[model samples]
Target: MKRIICILSMLLCMAAETVMAARAPVSEATEECLGCHSSIHPGIVEEWQNSRHARITPREALGVTGLARKVSARTVPDYLLPTAVGCAECHTLNAKVHADTFEHNGVSIHLAVSPRDCATCHTEEAVRYSGNLMAHARKNLAANPLYQDLQQQILGRPVRREGKLTFEPPAAETRQSGCFYCHGTRLEVVGMETRDTVLGEMEFPRLSGWPNQGVGRVNTDGSLGSCAACHTRHAFSIEMARKPHTCRECHVGPDVPAYKVYASSKHGNIYAAMNRQWDFSAVPWTVGKDFTAPTCATCHISLVVNTDGQVLARRTHEMSGRLAWRIFGLIYAHPHPMNPDTTRIRNKSGQPLPTDFDGTYAAEYLIDAGEQVRRTETMQAICLGCHSASWVRGHWKRFERTIRETRSDIRAATGIMADIWARGFAKGPDSDDSPFNEAIERTWCDAWLFYANTVRFSAAMAGGGDYSVFADGRYQLSRRIQELNDWLELRNQLFPPTPPIALRGLPEKPYRVQ
Candidate 1:
């Protein structure tokens, strides 16, 4: 018994040493941080304090929670009680501890509390976010200048992205960084070397880890990120990552509007009605097998594990997951490799180069379809567990038509804009300016991004059935369209650009609507 006790103590000491050794030597102030934080936050403090963000790994930290912990011989074992992901200690930084708990408000408290604050907790997550086009403020605003143009109608005045108070500005603060809270700094942090809070305005690192939690954080040392945004810290449990609750943080906004989209999907409906059926505790989650219906992870992330399980992988944290295609774009289907055919690519090697487009046709075909058809099929299959196959098919068939029509309206709006330019009102191809003319932007904004997202999201799920239509789907859509028309007429714009007459002269382009 005495020998075992001695050996265990030695093991504990060695574990502590292993953790300490992995970290960079602390500066005097950082030393002060290490001294008190580890004691207060304990294992999680030490564990995540030395995470990839601490060491500078470009990939983001884990969003999933950790497994349960055990206390033996009065000493806590390897696992922990919902804290920051412990990198190598709890296994890689991505593993979820258990199941069903994805709300990460800890990010708001730990880092800056704004949409721009994503970098506060999801710095690495933002890279993929920027690529998503929806998260890119510049790109998204450019896509539909009207979203920004119509702000005054809803917000009553424009606010800065910084969440600052102002009269009528160019853009509202929420539109700027998707928040009305926090300073909306691109980055917020404290330098261990400088040993001080060096952000919008603060004295300490907030909750330590250099006080960085801006969603779009730009970082002080030119290194950019905010790992704490999504995965959070202090009690970063896997259960939190498993639930759809975590995504609501920023997803439920006017811009990158996912909260509305999800609320309308058939999968969302089934899950909401039958959430109890899901067995979130399972690994590599599936829809019917592990639980009952589907969740966000079922259609977006990892391959389907069973039928009702939601095993969102630890390796992915882009919010968009590792998904390739941008489905919500003007056109449907993904571009090139993001969307690929293995057999076609293999056959192409025997033929000519890039000029021989036919040679790699198969490879291109692979790119055109769903990368993981099984997952898509699995999601649809979950609906069968409740409704009949014919019922499901019939609904999608109608849905497909609605999507097509909505897309047509979008094309019509674009056509109107193009005609205005082709004639004499706006800049033509020869000109380099496509600046938002607040007026013209107002027209296009309602035509697509807003109305489009709402109607499309409504069609994607249980259409007029529930209260979805009034909540976010049609209410926002109609308002946007009305705003656009009101702005267009007020600006003396050629509404719809002489529709039927000009339709003949408009240039042709291949478009994929649903």
Candidate 2:
């Protein structure tokens, strides 16, 4: 019995030793990777070296308190705790699970690091961002039939061929450079192909919709968004994400124009002049000390702090937390919707609101009124950091009034278009014919899409007098209305009015001379 007991103890000790060896940190392997990559990609190596990732080991970071503890690994293997973040740490964590991993010179590597991989460390941010509008941007825009119809009508050219109107789709190059650049394109793996390199022949993923960093990118591993959209590659600098130029990648246009309006504002001027002196890397970004004026991130995403270093608000990946109203004013000005899932929402009339109304805010599909008010107050609190309460209140009042005024103008234009459609001057709204092909419909679209959006964005951002008055604002609004009236009058003359039907029986006998 003593011999059997001793034999059992020896076996248990051997099993424990084998498990520890298997769990040992791959820091030595990481060093070998850096040794070669450091010479081949020195700039990337330098950037990583400067990053906080390289400076702090998992063990050191796990020992800290507060936010540090929250972001650190909850339970790191004993072997990995001592190594600073490096190439092998990320690429080889779970090699067998990835679909696109390849073996190179006796090491396994994945070409793409998916959100699932990043979530291993940034669990909270990954989850929050998964629900963000940006994560579903491709589906919301591409999956909607109405949006596709508009895209085909607007982006494509219509020509009368063989006595019938035929739509010619836009060139592939134009779409790739324009809309899809930001809205994201669906990715597909064509298959694996062999390529000859200095290392010898190797197999690599043949992918489409690649070399893109659009926010809603559909990665090969089935993730929804690209962290690189804002963070950028290897460096993944916070400063880049916090700047306005990064957002300008998609937001700068006649319809959106957020970055354009902001660039011309007083706050933009201050940022341009003094941003070099500011410390963008600081946590709990101080309002006065870190920056005198607000950047896009400052107002939307950053965890702001007072001058005394007291936190005023927590950071958020869900950007809509402070936005009460969506100023895009698609058909008319409306409140922000609950989520980006346009398919499930319906309006008061029981019709599909997302397909019919451009910007109608379905109350049931969104957060309650109380929650909206709270969000509005949260935004106002941010404004209070620089302006007086009265000033903030007055500014918001003006902004609200501006939205109402813009909606009124849009309604007038809509009436004219509806009248035109009713009288058969153009194809009716519900007809199979394309509503946007005619001259009048195009003009009406511009009224709501371009000019009205400019006025609202200008008002909301406090863009100076010039933008609201001259640069596609009130002046364009009035001009567009006049153009619509002129077109209607000309169309009436061309068609001519039909004579009134002759009255039957006794009524026809008494015709008065005018």
Candidate 3:
């Protein structure tokens, strides 16, 4: 027994030495960074120490072949290939191009690390993500005037004025904390600020959008998207990125309740119950082997394989690469946009919406039928990893039916809103008043934005429980439509009718006095 115990101890010591040897040497610059940070910010250092970046060099990563390969760059600069990815590796890369670059402890370093720097070793992922809608999230939301109005209605401060609620443009801090929290903020170096640090007074760039990790963050290097949004900072752990909790940070809102719907799903239930037994770090993540259930990454981005090691789906950084429909409708569900920059799209009414108020799509800006079919097949392939063809087909049939039914519901609500606007009961698009500001108009918006969105998510994810019936689903949808009709009736009864306003190129009011 004593001889066996000694042998086991010797083996463990050898294993520890092997692990230490496998870790690529940290560069001299990174060593300097760690000299101070390892003590000053011990937590950050510890997390990074446990990351894959701490263990492997670009040279070793690039040598890996097949679907298991993580690094997509074919060749890395000689200077970078020899070192483990560390503070200096990422923060010092392309320093000349970064406007926020500043001398930090005698070394040039940028506060915000952009995708452009990461593209040094992840060329394919960076290029692919550049085409994802998430990469253009800030521009898609902020640049579009129509969306700006909607944002104002949702985030603006409300005050009662002249017996009605009027909204003030939200403060910059308000926007930073609200919608921009997920959509990302445009970061810029406003000026320099001096701070007392462990090493005494140090001058650092004061970034306007500091501390943001939103998916579409505009970095100081003019790069779109923040890889840290998923991979996380310091550690950049693949295990954390593969977990649904990372996605839950941004997708838990009522407007886009992907996480909420997923939490209620059978897949989510299985994940919640058995996730501890799963292998989140496995490359070519095998369905039913690595994970018995899907996380957000599993269905959207992860490279998946079958039990027999056959490739099921290729890894993707373009989150919407397999999506046929953009279920998060502005007014109604429509096909996915052709370009990631949805700001370039305009409807017939000259609105920067994929679909007009009446449900006509901006066809030229959206993906064509063939593209949609291809994307649908791609998504269906992922489904087939766990489900039979008949089951997958049936699920899609229900989802398609839900989209059609919800569109009809929204059309009904929009027609009611148009009637209210025509009768001059509320301000509208033609009258220079925000269409989303009024109480009734907000209710109309809820029909599509909240309730319809929840229903679609529930159907699409096959998590058809209260989410599809009660929790911001069909019940709320039916009640919201009824409430809009009631609101218009109440408004008519409360006030004297004036002559209808000029049609403003809209159709005649759909109702008249008896």
Candidate 4:
């Protein structure tokens, strides 16, 4: 009888809890959105239901203090405190600014949610990210004529015309799929289109760059970035953001290869072996306790803590905040840019590049040595969370050495290319022809852009095994330099610079002679 009564009491408590959860406060606007979308976008609804936004209000979230506090806004409006952050909360918050805003069921609804929308609750993160290089990714590539030319050379289709190749400019769709897919697209509300829906035929704003979620996406609201790039939409899950897989979508390509390097690293080995047992959702991610191995987030972004509740590193939305060097090899690896907008930078040659062709830095645009040292110390602090002082020091020493060594290799390749250009074998910037248009020039690009970058990333991540030795690294570097030399030598011997068509006399008739 006692056991039966206990079971009945437990059932009653469970029922009451379920009733309370069902009665959780939801705004009328959100309820209205749910009425249609719950059925129309069941997956979206399901994802939100599992999110923290659906479970807690701004009031409750703001109450959390210390390192565990995710909400950066010191206070929120009383109107927003009573209800969960739902579809309408984000989509309808800043409606006046968004050109894509349209009336749907008598409510102002915006299609694209910008970083500005998320800033309501996550103010600090939004602010920090505004100054991040990622925020200006689109402008950096599209605004620079040199980079634009390189992009065109890579994406443009080439056709053989009169024994010479001519490249046709890539179509808009091709550019969107190639570079803008990762860098970002300039989104605009072109017009409105009426669409048949479950509710009825309704008018919706037609967006130019509809499906892009690039980090630096320009939204109709005039905001610089898309929060959905990392957080994802409807769910906004931290766990998903913290995972290495989230970064792999953009960084796994040959140009970056960050994910591939990480996947093969010693840290990656540990993560692969022990990740199932790790707690990914911890607020202040404890290094040894929460996760045994470092994910991409652990080193770059997350607010990490030691076991004693001491902060190892503060969280940052500026992804390059802890980075001293920009290892992507804009010709050669240089210090990180001082400002997020690199368009203003002019090298010695008046080109909008951080470094000149000869590897001289546009020093005014790059961070000073003091700033680099500070950033390096910040990164070292994160390393100290799991590694000893000597180990960290040694690792940095090796990384610095690798940077010097790789730059030397790039210089050698650049010298050969310079000689080729001087010899009139390949057209260069001076000739007003794209340096990246010809095969040998593209091969030169591979030396710096692909192989050097791969080796540098390997050294930085301590993933140097096959990556450093064989796979598009030292081995490829040696082979490509040799190939460049061989090409120059062969061209000198067999094929001299082609004379102008007018300079060469017309071919004689083939039928001459019997």
For candidate 1, write residues 169-212 as lDDT tens digits: 43433444433221123433323122323223222342222233
Q: What TM-score number comes out for model 4?
A: 0.93
**C-alpha RMSD for every candidate:** 13.5, 12.8, 4.0, 6.8
TM-score for predicted model 2 compared with the true structure? 0.84
The runs of at least 3 residues in candidate 3 whose Cα sits more than 4 Å from the true structure, single-residue gaps closed, are 1-19, 161-164, 493-514
State the local distance difference test value for candidate 4: 0.87
- TM-score of every prediction relative to native: 0.51, 0.84, 0.94, 0.93
True-vs-predicted CA distance for residue 270, candidate 3, Å = 0.8
As for TM-score, the candidate ahead, 1 or 2, is 2
Comparing candidate 1 with candidate 3, which one achieves the higher lDDT? 3
lDDT of each: 0.42, 0.72, 0.88, 0.87
Between candidates 2 and 4, name the one with more favorable TM-score. Answer: 4
Q: Compared to the true structure, candidate 3 yields what TM-score?
A: 0.94
Top candidate on lDDT is 3
On TM-score, the stronger of 1 and 3 is 3
Model 2 lDDT per residue over 340-394, tens place: 6655555553433421333345667767778768888888877888899999999
Best-first order by lDDT: 3, 4, 2, 1
Off by over 4 Å in 2: 1-26, 67-80, 92-98, 157-160, 163-166, 170-174, 346-361, 496-514
- Candidate 3 colliding pairs: none
